[model samples]
Target: MAAAPPPPSCCLVALPPHAKDGLVVFGKNSARPRDEVQEVVYFPAADHEPESKVECTYISVDQVPKTHAIVISRPAWLWGAEMGANDQG
Candidate 1:
């Protein structure tokens, strides 16, 4: 059988404002630890559908702060939708 994907690490940390809501933060990993930033956003549930009102937005790493902590907001929700860690679907 093929190997299963590894469980997510505990290093995930969400930022202050949205942390209490279960948001997670992610950064780049290098040979030595260094700070890198990226942002992936999700719209309201109703907007997820093709004809929904919500507009999906993808903010590239260059748009956000390099050291700023991003809010993953809903990891399980993303996974449930079949969107892997690096996927935004």
Candidate 2:
């Protein structure tokens, strides 16, 4: 028998008048191979206290004196964001 088709990856955005708030929606289907590994991570807010540093990479830079919280979904062995969203206001 022939193999079945894969599911579709989709995203939806609802927009109204500029005076009103809108909504955003995302849905990922069977886009990646089943053997691959992905992880969803949550980063809490720093509140701009002693400042945040960039130690997650191979380079060094200035500290972030101000920042917000965020969540990212990326590869299991890499520090990259394939999909991410912020929880800030």
User: How displaced is residue 51 in candidate 2, in Å?
Assistant: 7.9
lDDT for every model? 0.36, 0.66
Query: Which prediction has the highest lDDT against the true structure?
Result: 2
Off by over 4 Å in 2: 1-23, 29-33, 47-52
Lowest summed lDDT across 10 adjacent residues in model 2 is found at: 10-19
The Cα error of candidate 1 at residue 60, in Å, is: 19
Candidate 1 lDDT, 20-54, residue by residue in tens:
76556654322322242323454332213333332
Model 2 TM: 0.56
Root-mean-square deviation of each candidate, in angstroms?
13.9, 5.8
Task: Give the lDDT of residue 77 in candidate 2.
Answer: 71
Clashing pairs in 2: none
Q: Over the stretch 1-89, how does candidate 2's per-residue lDDT look in tens digits?
A: 99978545555444555335564445555366678898889988765546455755466565677656788887787665777778753
| Candidate 2 residue-wise lDDT at 58 | 62
lDDT of 2 at 33: 61
